[model samples]
Target: MKPALESSPGNPLAHLPFYYLDNFHRVLDWIGDRYADLLDGEEQAFLAGFPALPQPSRALFVRMVMRKGQLFRASKLQYDEIGCPRAAAAPLADAGWVVADPAVTLDELFDLLQKPEICRAFALPAGLKAARKDAQLEALRAAHDGARPFSGWFDGDAAYRIVAKPLCDRLRLIFFGNYHQDWTEFVLSDLGVYRFEKVEFADAARGFRTRRDIDEYLQLHACRERFGNGEHPADVLHDVPPPGTDNEWLKSRRDKLLFQLGQQFEKLRDWAGAHAVYRECGYPGARARAIRVLEKDERYGPAWELLQHALREPESEAERQHLLRMAPRLARHLGHPRTAAGRLAPPRRLDLALPQPDGDWWVEGVVRDHLCRDDAPVFYVENALINSLFGLLCWDAVFAAIPGAFFHPFHHGPADLHSADFHRRRADRFAACLAQLDDGSYVDTIRHNLVAKYGISSPFVYWNALDEDLLELALHCIPPAHLKHAFLRILQDVKANRAGFPDLIQFWPAERRYAMIEVKGPGDRLQDNQLRWIDYCARHDMPVTVCYLQWTQQ
Candidate 1:
């Protein structure tokens, strides 16, 4: 039979024999099927109309046609006809050097296309010829370099194929065959187009052998004996290596890997693993930071242990302070309130003298009686009665004892009194006294005294005569007005809505029925609206009280 391209003049494979065409048809069919989707209507029609070529030219034609088709399809145009071998084939055939085949399979064509000697028969460009020779030389070099007893036939045969097995072996050695396992498998397996039977089988076996060798090496060299038979393979793999090694490259690689692993662990909320990696890096700050992250997630035990370990390491005073602050909060969160309290050092003691009520009996004596005694009359007599009487008798003496200590002027000296310094001092003393009281009795006594004595008759008089400074100071020192307002608003809403006010609100003296309470100092007369509000409240059965203290009290 004549070569397939003998009818065409410039055919590159015009010199090859007919027997080589057996394998070329397989590659043509594969190209047609593989690129069917990408081909345009015109190209598909043209390809469909074209018949398979004959002989060695057929195999060569498949490769050249596929490559040109791919380039044309990619560039969306026809390519230059640099060396038109098909056109030259007729002349070569005339010289009785060419042959052709009538029928062939796509697989057979693929095999023939892969044979290096057959490929060289094509009328290739000078650059391509040089490249092909260089590739062959390199393949030979690789085969010689990687020549092992078992790999001899495989490597030598691959050197003659399109892809060299020896070069693949060298690559495996250089990269340890650890990187891109899937990619290497793809290139060496049935999935690859360069499928020389011997090379394919050899690569498959090599892959299996390499995997087994790796497993065996790990089992033999790694501390596998330390891991009981019950341990998981993954756990053994992870714990096998020591944190750091003398190999600087390995150590650096490990550090990077560990850091990346720690980040992933943190994302997974694997606090234990994250902390372990951080600890391995020997970065106390990072470890502490990881512990903090774990703590936020309520991984208490692990975070606590990590923190303890970090604390034991050499750390700055700032770090200690941070730990000190965090310990109490964490302890409280962990349901150890007492431990939290223990972490707080004792508060420094103040040097100010305690307020004495009257007749050498300190205010504490009256406050204590009020709290301890059940007798209402006795309680009033000791806590409220003595102070009320003493306040009315020698107001200065009582005011002097507790400066800025009363809630209102009514609780201290007279209000018509205009001495700012006296009121200021009395306000201060009253504040100090209330500070000592530290209970609800003081508020109750003041409210009860006002109601019992003044009877809400003139809310302005009760509020005006009250030590506003002392009242304000006392209130501030106690629960504070904003908190008091919140509590009162809630109580009022509850009462108004019939929700039932809390018992605590009833205990608050500020909630008592007063027409109007003016918050001002002594000698500070009521404003017109204040008087109007007082009048309005009186008419509406809402009593008013004024709460303020003189500036001198400060």
Candidate 2:
């Protein structure tokens, strides 16, 4: 079997394995059909001329473009897994794409792919001689121009040509792993196809339904000479196909796409077109976009009216909070007298007593020490053990239930469902995930994460945070319903509520009774989110105690 090149960072060309190479080559072919009009006369000539060449020759040129290197070994073509191999080197040589050198051999190719220190250990056995160099390879390395040692197309001194759209398209796909912003911007900007600032569109709303819809539509349309010149997505979006479903998730996608389209036009200083797109797609966030457009146009009255509407019913509490904070500034902009700021209603404090005077670290220790003699055994768990560690433990189950929950913007966690209503959309799946915590499967999931996923490096195993004793205590004492409720509560706002769980948990192993204790040192107060969680626990009849630490004078 070939060496695994999946995560080989040292050799950037490692991704040119048979599997990825196949799709990349195909996308390249599509690029010709997709963007032929964007090509200059010379590039069009290349496209017309490419298919006339032998398949082997095409393969070799494609490999050269894929490798993005001047020098390559002929033996690399011998790999049976690839489309073209050693038997097909003649076409590439005749075409002058490679200056295949005899010095570069299969041994050298393998050595290049392997680390320097380990190459010797994996070196080819003796008695195998490298095949003779083909004419293309020899001619390339031998070409000389302008008094240089070697100067061919591959030479650094050779006149640079604008890369054909298909080749550039292929390269972009290979590098970014998707044809999104990188490919779109590169093919349009680098190809000199669309000078965005000068480009104008007649029917900006005819062809696009979503961002990807606009991108693919433009990519396909912009290369045809008739449609290629100064095409506007805002013009053709109306002609886009109706969506298969009118669900909220799909609606949100259209909303986001419309917002993005507006932003792009605004960036181009096409305020009218931008405003039209925003109004056409008046989703939840679109009003905010409309306000900005009005403000940009110096229509303060309309902007203020739109701003008030946006503030009245934001998509989320967070958005409402943001709008509330932005209100005074918008009022000032419109020359309104400053309104007195209202104070927040203070949080009702929960009065719970700790056994002794303690500091931050001592609070948990003191709680544990007090609970040691109780009928229930107590454990002081760090924040991570309760939330992050537990989160990882149950990740697989939750992922199975609500796959979209894993979709994080940072690419930090996991999942990639592109819907604004992700949490709401996956409510059933989240409930399924909660079911896992409610059952006895929590032990299996935790063990799987620790032993199978992290092995020795698991924080639960390595950091002495989660032990067999605590696990046993939890299994014996913590009710599955309570655990399920806790998990469900956190899932409501995973990012915000995963932490702030009680520091100490006391459990009666025999009676299957457990209680959570949030330890607070002097001057410490419960955060709003934490208070919300506390209120949830109280309503749900889950045992929770707020242990305030009154420090003793030394």
Give the TM-score of each candidate. Answer: 0.21, 0.42
| 455: Cα error in model 1, Å | 94
Q: Can you write out model 1's per-residue Cα lDDT over 1-554, one digit (the tens) per residue?
A: 12233334654334443323333233234435443443344445434533432333333333332231111111121223213444433332333223222122222222334445424434445554556554544434532443232122222221111112222222222223223222222222222222211111122212113333333333333433433343433354375455433322233333544555566567667766776666675322456556666786788877777667766862432344456556666776677664432122221121222233347643323333432322211111111221232232222233342321221112222211222133233454445434423444446455444445442222112333344333433343334232233222222222121111110100123442111123333354544323333333344343233333333222
Candidate No. with top lDDT: 2
Off by over 4 Å in 1: 1-244, 276-286, 293-302, 311-554
Segments of candidate 2 deviating more than 4 angstroms? 1-66, 69-88, 91-289, 292-301, 304-313, 328-390, 393-398, 401-415, 435-449, 452-554
> Cα deviation of 186 in candidate 2 (Å)?
26
Clashes of 2: 22
Q: Count the clashes in each prediction.
A: 76, 22
For candidate 2, report its TM-score.
0.42
Q: Which 10-residue window of candidate 2 scores lowest in summed lDDT?
A: 152-161
